[model samples]
Target: MADFLGTDANPSLDGILYPSVQGSEGKLNVVLFHKAARVQALDIPKGAEISADLYVETEDGLEIDYSVWEEVPPESPSATSNRDPLDAREPEDYNGRVPTLRLNISSLRVHRVNHIMFHTESHTVRRHRFEKRGAEF
Candidate 1:
Protein backbone atom coordinates (compact mmCIF):
# COMPACT_ATOMS: atom_id res chain seq x y z
CA MET A 1 0.00 0.00 0.00
CA ALA A 2 2.99 2.26 -0.13
CA ASP A 3 3.12 2.75 -3.86
CA PHE A 4 1.74 6.21 -3.08
CA LEU A 5 -0.16 6.30 -6.34
CA GLY A 6 2.61 4.83 -8.39
CA THR A 7 -0.14 2.48 -9.37
CA ASP A 8 1.95 -0.34 -8.12
CA ALA A 9 5.08 1.72 -8.39
CA ASN A 10 8.36 0.19 -9.43
CA PRO A 11 7.90 -0.10 -13.11
CA SER A 12 10.80 2.28 -12.56
CA LEU A 13 10.52 6.03 -12.99
CA ASP A 14 12.62 8.09 -10.70
CA GLY A 15 12.24 10.85 -13.28
CA ILE A 16 9.91 10.87 -16.27
CA LEU A 17 8.50 8.41 -18.70
CA TYR A 18 5.47 8.50 -20.99
CA PRO A 19 5.40 5.09 -22.57
CA SER A 20 2.34 3.67 -24.21
CA VAL A 21 1.01 1.87 -21.13
CA GLN A 22 1.18 -1.55 -22.73
CA GLY A 23 0.27 -4.04 -20.04
CA SER A 24 0.62 -4.27 -16.26
CA GLU A 25 2.29 -0.87 -16.32
CA GLY A 26 1.14 2.25 -14.55
CA LYS A 27 2.49 5.43 -12.97
CA LEU A 28 1.69 8.38 -10.79
CA ASN A 29 2.54 12.00 -9.94
CA VAL A 30 -0.51 13.48 -8.33
CA VAL A 31 -2.70 16.15 -10.00
CA LEU A 32 -5.77 14.44 -8.64
CA PHE A 33 -5.53 12.12 -11.65
CA HIS A 34 -8.76 13.70 -12.73
CA LYS A 35 -10.55 12.71 -9.57
CA ALA A 36 -9.39 9.17 -10.29
CA ALA A 37 -10.73 9.32 -13.79
CA ARG A 38 -14.16 10.34 -12.66
CA VAL A 39 -14.56 7.64 -10.06
CA GLN A 40 -12.87 4.84 -11.96
CA ALA A 41 -14.55 5.11 -15.29
CA LEU A 42 -11.04 5.96 -16.48
CA ASP A 43 -12.62 8.98 -18.19
CA ILE A 44 -14.52 6.51 -20.33
CA PRO A 45 -12.49 5.55 -23.37
CA LYS A 46 -12.05 1.76 -23.58
CA GLY A 47 -15.31 0.76 -25.13
CA ALA A 48 -14.05 -1.90 -27.49
CA GLU A 49 -15.65 -4.55 -25.31
CA ILE A 50 -13.16 -4.52 -22.38
CA SER A 51 -12.05 -8.00 -23.32
CA ALA A 52 -8.46 -8.32 -22.44
CA ASP A 53 -9.45 -11.53 -20.80
CA LEU A 54 -12.21 -9.56 -19.16
CA TYR A 55 -9.77 -6.82 -18.28
CA VAL A 56 -7.47 -9.09 -16.38
CA GLU A 57 -10.29 -10.79 -14.62
CA THR A 58 -12.16 -7.76 -13.39
CA GLU A 59 -9.55 -5.10 -13.15
CA ASP A 60 -9.52 -3.70 -9.63
CA GLY A 61 -6.54 -1.42 -9.55
CA LEU A 62 -8.78 1.19 -7.98
CA GLU A 63 -6.46 3.69 -9.60
CA ILE A 64 -3.72 2.46 -7.35
CA ASP A 65 -6.05 2.15 -4.43
CA TYR A 66 -7.55 5.63 -4.56
CA SER A 67 -5.20 8.40 -5.65
CA VAL A 68 -5.05 11.11 -2.98
CA TRP A 69 -3.04 13.99 -4.40
CA GLU A 70 -4.51 16.65 -2.12
CA GLU A 71 -1.68 18.90 -3.19
CA VAL A 72 0.83 16.29 -2.04
CA PRO A 73 -0.56 16.29 1.50
CA PRO A 74 -3.43 18.63 2.12
CA GLU A 75 -5.45 17.33 5.01
CA SER A 76 -5.45 19.10 8.29
CA PRO A 77 -6.52 18.79 11.93
CA SER A 78 -2.90 17.97 12.46
CA ALA A 79 -3.30 15.39 9.77
CA THR A 80 -6.41 13.83 11.21
CA SER A 81 -5.14 13.59 14.77
CA ASN A 82 -2.39 11.06 14.20
CA ARG A 83 -4.71 8.18 13.73
CA ASP A 84 -5.18 5.17 16.00
CA PRO A 85 -8.30 3.66 14.59
CA LEU A 86 -7.73 0.40 16.40
CA ASP A 87 -4.27 0.39 14.84
CA ALA A 88 -4.72 -2.39 12.35
CA ARG A 89 -2.12 -1.10 9.94
CA GLU A 90 -3.24 2.29 8.78
CA PRO A 91 -2.92 3.74 5.30
CA GLU A 92 -6.11 5.28 4.18
CA ASP A 93 -7.17 7.66 1.45
CA TYR A 94 -10.88 7.40 1.65
CA ASN A 95 -10.93 10.07 -1.00
CA GLY A 96 -12.92 7.43 -2.79
CA ARG A 97 -15.37 7.39 0.00
CA VAL A 98 -17.93 4.96 1.28
CA PRO A 99 -17.86 6.04 4.91
CA THR A 100 -19.70 3.19 6.59
CA LEU A 101 -22.45 3.72 4.10
CA ARG A 102 -23.95 7.15 4.36
CA LEU A 103 -25.51 6.49 1.04
CA ASN A 104 -22.01 5.58 -0.11
CA ILE A 105 -20.81 8.96 -1.23
CA SER A 106 -17.43 9.49 -2.87
CA SER A 107 -15.43 12.67 -2.43
CA LEU A 108 -13.04 15.07 -4.18
CA ARG A 109 -14.50 17.98 -6.07
CA VAL A 110 -12.11 20.62 -7.44
CA HIS A 111 -13.77 22.90 -9.88
CA ARG A 112 -12.42 25.87 -11.88
CA VAL A 113 -8.85 25.68 -12.95
CA ASN A 114 -7.94 25.79 -16.59
CA HIS A 115 -4.67 27.25 -17.75
CA ILE A 116 -3.02 25.18 -20.37
CA MET A 117 -0.24 25.16 -22.90
CA PHE A 118 0.85 21.71 -23.80
CA HIS A 119 3.19 20.15 -26.34
CA THR A 120 5.18 16.96 -26.07
CA GLU A 121 6.19 15.03 -29.13
CA SER A 122 9.25 12.98 -28.45
CA HIS A 123 8.36 11.06 -31.54
CA THR A 124 4.91 10.78 -30.05
CA VAL A 125 5.90 9.38 -26.68
CA ARG A 126 7.31 6.20 -25.20
CA ARG A 127 9.08 6.47 -21.90
CA HIS A 128 9.12 3.77 -19.24
CA ARG A 129 8.94 1.12 -21.88
CA PHE A 130 8.14 -2.23 -20.27
CA GLU A 131 7.19 -5.16 -22.45
CA LYS A 132 7.52 -8.25 -20.30
CA ARG A 133 4.07 -9.63 -20.35
CA GLY A 134 2.49 -13.15 -20.13
CA ALA A 135 1.31 -13.44 -16.54
CA GLU A 136 -2.11 -13.96 -17.99
CA PHE A 137 -3.62 -12.99 -14.69
Candidate 2:
Protein backbone atom coordinates (compact mmCIF):
# COMPACT_ATOMS: atom_id res chain seq x y z
CA MET A 1 0.00 0.00 0.00
CA ALA A 2 1.11 3.57 -0.74
CA ASP A 3 0.37 5.73 2.30
CA PHE A 4 -0.30 9.43 1.69
CA LEU A 5 -1.69 11.30 4.67
CA GLY A 6 0.88 10.24 7.25
CA THR A 7 3.96 10.58 5.07
CA ASP A 8 6.05 13.66 5.69
CA ALA A 9 7.03 15.61 2.56
CA ASN A 10 9.17 18.20 4.25
CA PRO A 11 12.51 17.37 5.80
CA SER A 12 11.96 20.00 8.44
CA LEU A 13 9.11 18.03 9.95
CA ASP A 14 11.41 15.01 10.54
CA GLY A 15 10.23 11.53 11.66
CA ILE A 16 6.97 10.50 13.27
CA LEU A 17 6.94 11.36 16.93
CA TYR A 18 5.52 8.85 19.35
CA PRO A 19 2.19 9.83 20.91
CA SER A 20 2.04 11.99 17.68
CA VAL A 21 0.30 14.84 19.45
CA GLN A 22 1.08 18.36 20.58
CA GLY A 23 -0.29 21.13 22.82
CA SER A 24 -2.77 20.83 25.71
CA GLU A 25 -6.38 19.62 26.00
CA GLY A 26 -8.00 22.88 24.84
CA LYS A 27 -5.87 22.96 21.65
CA LEU A 28 -3.71 20.34 19.96
CA ASN A 29 -2.64 18.84 16.64
CA VAL A 30 -2.55 15.11 15.83
CA VAL A 31 0.36 14.44 13.48
CA LEU A 32 0.97 11.29 11.40
CA PHE A 33 3.91 10.62 9.11
CA HIS A 34 5.86 8.17 6.98
CA LYS A 35 9.36 8.77 5.62
CA ALA A 36 8.77 7.14 2.25
CA ALA A 37 6.33 7.74 -0.68
CA ARG A 38 6.86 11.54 -0.81
CA VAL A 39 3.34 12.02 0.50
CA GLN A 40 2.00 15.26 1.91
CA ALA A 41 1.54 15.81 5.64
CA LEU A 42 -1.70 15.04 7.51
CA ASP A 43 -2.18 17.12 10.62
CA ILE A 44 -5.57 17.00 12.29
CA PRO A 45 -7.41 18.35 15.31
CA LYS A 46 -10.42 17.38 17.45
CA GLY A 47 -12.85 18.66 14.85
CA ALA A 48 -11.66 16.02 12.38
CA GLU A 49 -13.65 13.56 14.44
CA ILE A 50 -16.60 14.19 12.14
CA SER A 51 -15.33 15.90 8.98
CA ALA A 52 -13.02 13.44 7.12
CA ASP A 53 -11.31 10.07 6.89
CA LEU A 54 -7.58 9.33 6.51
CA TYR A 55 -6.59 6.70 3.98
CA VAL A 56 -3.56 4.88 2.60
CA GLU A 57 -3.53 3.42 -0.89
CA THR A 58 -2.83 -0.23 -1.50
CA GLU A 59 -0.91 -2.01 -4.31
CA ASP A 60 -4.30 -2.85 -5.71
CA GLY A 61 -6.09 0.38 -6.53
CA LEU A 62 -9.34 -1.32 -5.64
CA GLU A 63 -8.44 -1.21 -1.99
CA ILE A 64 -7.49 1.49 0.52
CA ASP A 65 -6.96 1.52 4.31
CA TYR A 66 -8.11 4.32 6.56
CA SER A 67 -7.87 5.62 10.12
CA VAL A 68 -9.26 8.41 12.29
CA TRP A 69 -8.36 10.11 15.57
CA GLU A 70 -10.88 11.81 17.82
CA GLU A 71 -10.04 14.41 20.42
CA VAL A 72 -11.21 13.97 24.02
CA PRO A 73 -10.38 15.54 27.32
CA PRO A 74 -9.10 13.71 30.36
CA GLU A 75 -11.07 13.68 33.60
CA SER A 76 -10.17 17.22 34.55
CA PRO A 77 -12.20 19.28 36.96
CA SER A 78 -11.35 22.47 35.07
CA ALA A 79 -12.90 20.99 31.92
CA THR A 80 -16.37 20.76 33.47
CA SER A 81 -18.88 23.19 32.01
CA ASN A 82 -21.93 25.08 33.19
CA ARG A 83 -23.34 25.78 29.73
CA ASP A 84 -25.05 23.55 27.21
CA PRO A 85 -23.65 20.01 27.06
CA LEU A 86 -23.51 20.19 23.25
CA ASP A 87 -21.10 23.09 23.41
CA ALA A 88 -17.79 21.82 21.95
CA ARG A 89 -15.48 24.11 23.85
CA GLU A 90 -15.23 26.53 26.72
CA PRO A 91 -16.61 30.02 26.24
CA GLU A 92 -14.26 32.94 26.14
CA ASP A 93 -14.32 36.69 25.47
CA TYR A 94 -13.17 37.97 22.11
CA ASN A 95 -14.35 41.12 20.35
CA GLY A 96 -16.94 41.36 23.14
CA ARG A 97 -18.12 37.86 22.26
CA VAL A 98 -17.32 34.32 23.31
CA PRO A 99 -15.25 31.76 21.43
CA THR A 100 -16.21 28.19 20.68
CA LEU A 101 -14.88 25.03 19.09
CA ARG A 102 -15.64 25.31 15.42
CA LEU A 103 -14.85 22.11 13.51
CA ASN A 104 -11.71 22.53 11.41
CA ILE A 105 -10.09 20.00 8.99
CA SER A 106 -7.57 22.11 7.13
CA SER A 107 -4.29 20.31 7.73
CA LEU A 108 -5.79 16.82 7.45
CA ARG A 109 -6.90 17.49 3.89
CA VAL A 110 -3.93 19.41 2.53
CA HIS A 111 -3.43 16.78 -0.18
CA ARG A 112 -7.01 16.67 -1.42
CA VAL A 113 -10.63 17.39 -0.44
CA ASN A 114 -12.48 14.14 -0.98
CA HIS A 115 -15.40 13.29 1.27
CA ILE A 116 -14.44 10.57 3.76
CA MET A 117 -15.59 9.04 7.04
CA PHE A 118 -12.75 8.04 9.33
CA HIS A 119 -13.06 5.69 12.29
CA THR A 120 -13.62 6.70 15.89
CA GLU A 121 -13.07 5.35 19.42
CA SER A 122 -14.14 5.99 22.97
CA HIS A 123 -10.66 7.22 23.85
CA THR A 124 -8.88 10.17 22.25
CA VAL A 125 -6.84 8.07 19.81
CA ARG A 126 -8.32 5.68 17.30
CA ARG A 127 -6.77 3.77 14.38
CA HIS A 128 -8.41 1.47 11.88
CA ARG A 129 -7.83 -0.32 8.57
CA PHE A 130 -10.45 -0.80 5.86
CA GLU A 131 -10.60 -1.62 2.17
CA LYS A 132 -11.92 1.14 -0.10
CA ARG A 133 -15.05 -0.29 -1.68
CA GLY A 134 -18.04 0.27 -3.94
CA ALA A 135 -20.70 0.22 -1.24
CA GLU A 136 -21.02 1.47 2.32
CA PHE A 137 -21.21 -1.89 4.07
Candidate 3:
Protein backbone atom coordinates (compact mmCIF):
# COMPACT_ATOMS: atom_id res chain seq x y z
CA MET A 1 0.00 0.00 0.00
CA ALA A 2 1.39 3.39 -1.06
CA ASP A 3 0.88 6.75 0.63
CA PHE A 4 -1.53 7.74 -2.19
CA LEU A 5 -1.47 11.51 -1.59
CA GLY A 6 -1.54 12.01 2.15
CA THR A 7 1.79 12.69 3.87
CA ASP A 8 2.90 9.22 4.88
CA ALA A 9 6.02 9.11 7.00
CA ASN A 10 7.86 6.39 5.14
CA PRO A 11 11.03 5.75 7.14
CA SER A 12 12.37 3.45 4.41
CA LEU A 13 12.92 6.55 2.25
CA ASP A 14 14.81 8.45 4.95
CA GLY A 15 18.20 8.47 3.23
CA ILE A 16 17.19 8.23 -0.42
CA LEU A 17 18.37 11.02 -2.74
CA TYR A 18 16.21 13.37 -4.85
CA PRO A 19 16.90 16.52 -6.85
CA SER A 20 16.12 19.39 -4.54
CA VAL A 21 14.86 22.50 -6.31
CA GLN A 22 15.28 26.01 -4.89
CA GLY A 23 12.38 27.53 -2.99
CA SER A 24 10.28 24.64 -4.18
CA GLU A 25 8.01 24.69 -1.18
CA GLY A 26 5.22 23.01 -3.08
CA LYS A 27 4.46 19.50 -1.88
CA LEU A 28 5.60 16.67 -4.15
CA ASN A 29 3.11 14.02 -5.20
CA VAL A 30 4.17 10.54 -6.29
CA VAL A 31 1.65 8.78 -8.56
CA LEU A 32 2.21 5.05 -8.92
CA PHE A 33 0.78 3.19 -11.94
CA HIS A 34 -0.75 -0.29 -11.86
CA LYS A 35 -3.78 -2.03 -13.38
CA ALA A 36 -5.80 -0.85 -10.41
CA ALA A 37 -4.25 2.61 -10.41
CA ARG A 38 -6.38 5.74 -10.37
CA VAL A 39 -5.66 9.43 -10.91
CA GLN A 40 -7.00 12.61 -9.40
CA ALA A 41 -5.64 15.81 -10.95
CA LEU A 42 -6.19 18.71 -8.65
CA ASP A 43 -4.93 22.24 -7.97
CA ILE A 44 -3.62 23.70 -11.19
CA PRO A 45 -1.48 26.66 -10.17
CA LYS A 46 -1.78 29.92 -12.13
CA GLY A 47 -0.13 29.69 -15.54
CA ALA A 48 1.38 26.25 -14.92
CA GLU A 49 2.28 23.75 -17.62
CA ILE A 50 1.68 20.05 -17.28
CA SER A 51 4.79 18.06 -18.02
CA ALA A 52 5.19 14.47 -19.15
CA ASP A 53 4.82 11.46 -16.88
CA LEU A 54 7.88 11.55 -14.63
CA TYR A 55 9.83 8.28 -14.70
CA VAL A 56 12.04 7.78 -11.65
CA GLU A 57 14.27 4.84 -12.42
CA THR A 58 15.76 2.97 -9.50
CA GLU A 59 17.87 -0.17 -9.30
CA ASP A 60 20.43 -1.88 -7.05
CA GLY A 61 21.51 -0.30 -3.73
CA LEU A 62 20.24 3.23 -4.37
CA GLU A 63 16.47 3.60 -4.89
CA ILE A 64 13.91 6.37 -5.20
CA ASP A 65 11.66 6.95 -2.19
CA TYR A 66 10.11 9.57 0.06
CA SER A 67 10.46 10.26 3.76
CA VAL A 68 8.62 12.29 6.36
CA TRP A 69 9.85 15.46 4.69
CA GLU A 70 11.24 18.06 7.07
CA GLU A 71 12.56 21.54 6.54
CA VAL A 72 16.28 21.95 7.27
CA PRO A 73 17.48 25.08 8.97
CA PRO A 74 20.20 27.12 7.27
CA GLU A 75 22.40 27.41 10.38
CA SER A 76 22.40 23.71 11.16
CA PRO A 77 25.69 21.80 11.05
CA SER A 78 24.48 19.49 8.30
CA ALA A 79 23.22 22.46 6.24
CA THR A 80 26.60 24.13 6.08
CA SER A 81 28.97 25.22 3.30
CA ASN A 82 29.72 21.55 2.53
CA ARG A 83 26.49 21.41 0.49
CA ASP A 84 25.62 23.27 -2.72
CA PRO A 85 22.43 25.18 -3.46
CA LEU A 86 20.02 23.60 -5.91
CA ASP A 87 18.35 25.17 -8.91
CA ALA A 88 15.88 23.63 -11.34
CA ARG A 89 18.45 22.90 -14.03
CA GLU A 90 21.34 22.43 -11.66
CA PRO A 91 19.46 20.91 -8.76
CA GLU A 92 21.26 19.02 -5.99
CA ASP A 93 20.43 15.68 -4.38
CA TYR A 94 20.69 16.16 -0.60
CA ASN A 95 18.99 13.02 0.78
CA GLY A 96 22.30 11.19 0.33
CA ARG A 97 23.63 10.88 3.88
CA VAL A 98 20.61 12.57 5.46
CA PRO A 99 17.33 14.32 4.74
CA THR A 100 18.22 17.91 3.90
CA LEU A 101 16.83 20.85 1.92
CA ARG A 102 18.88 24.02 1.34
CA LEU A 103 17.42 27.25 -0.07
CA ASN A 104 19.22 29.85 -2.20
CA ILE A 105 18.70 32.55 -4.81
CA SER A 106 17.76 31.01 -8.16
CA SER A 107 15.74 31.78 -11.27
CA LEU A 108 13.45 28.84 -10.58
CA ARG A 109 10.20 28.91 -8.63
CA VAL A 110 7.60 26.34 -7.74
CA HIS A 111 5.64 25.97 -10.92
CA ARG A 112 2.72 23.63 -11.42
CA VAL A 113 1.66 21.24 -8.63
CA ASN A 114 -1.03 18.57 -8.71
CA HIS A 115 -2.54 16.45 -5.97
CA ILE A 116 -2.05 12.87 -7.15
CA MET A 117 -4.51 10.11 -6.25
CA PHE A 118 -3.50 6.47 -6.42
CA HIS A 119 -5.36 3.11 -6.44
CA THR A 120 -3.92 -0.16 -5.17
CA GLU A 121 -4.83 -3.86 -5.48
CA SER A 122 -8.38 -4.33 -4.29
CA HIS A 123 -11.44 -6.37 -5.20
CA THR A 124 -13.41 -3.32 -6.23
CA VAL A 125 -12.27 -0.06 -7.85
CA ARG A 126 -12.61 3.16 -5.87
CA ARG A 127 -11.84 6.02 -8.26
CA HIS A 128 -11.50 6.59 -11.98
CA ARG A 129 -8.64 4.47 -13.29
CA PHE A 130 -5.84 6.28 -15.10
CA GLU A 131 -5.74 3.95 -18.09
CA LYS A 132 -2.89 5.71 -19.90
CA ARG A 133 -0.50 5.20 -17.03
CA GLY A 134 -2.01 1.88 -15.93
CA ALA A 135 -0.47 -1.47 -16.80
CA GLU A 136 -1.04 -5.19 -16.15
CA PHE A 137 0.83 -6.55 -13.20
Q: Which has the greatest TM-score?
A: 2
Candidate 1 lDDT over 1-137, as tens digits, reads: 32454254556322333534323337434232222333422322222223222122236652323233222334355643566766665356335532222222266443545664545556666569678988876
After superposing candidate 3, which stretches have Cα over 4 Å from the reference?
A: 1-14, 17-101, 123-137
Q: Tell me, what's the RMSD of every candidate? A: 21.2, 24.8, 23.2
For each candidate, what TM-score against the reference? 0.14, 0.19, 0.17
**Candidate 2 positional error at 21, Å:** 50
**Candidate 1 vs 2: which has more TM-score:** 2
Error of 2 at 60 (Å): 2.5
lDDT of 3 by residue, 33-89 (tens): 232232333434334444432234566545433222233334544433443356433
1 or 3, greater by TM-score: 3
lDDT for residue 114 in candidate 3, whole number 0-100: 60
Q: Model 1 TM-score? A: 0.14
- lDDT, model 2: 0.43
lDDT of 2 by residue, 1-137 (tens): 12433343443442343331233336544343333224333443323443335556667654444445466535456654467756565455213222222335444333545765545456577789998889768
Worst 10 residues of 3 by lDDT: 93-102
Worst 10 residues of 1 by lDDT: 46-55
Pick by lDDT: which candidate is best? 2
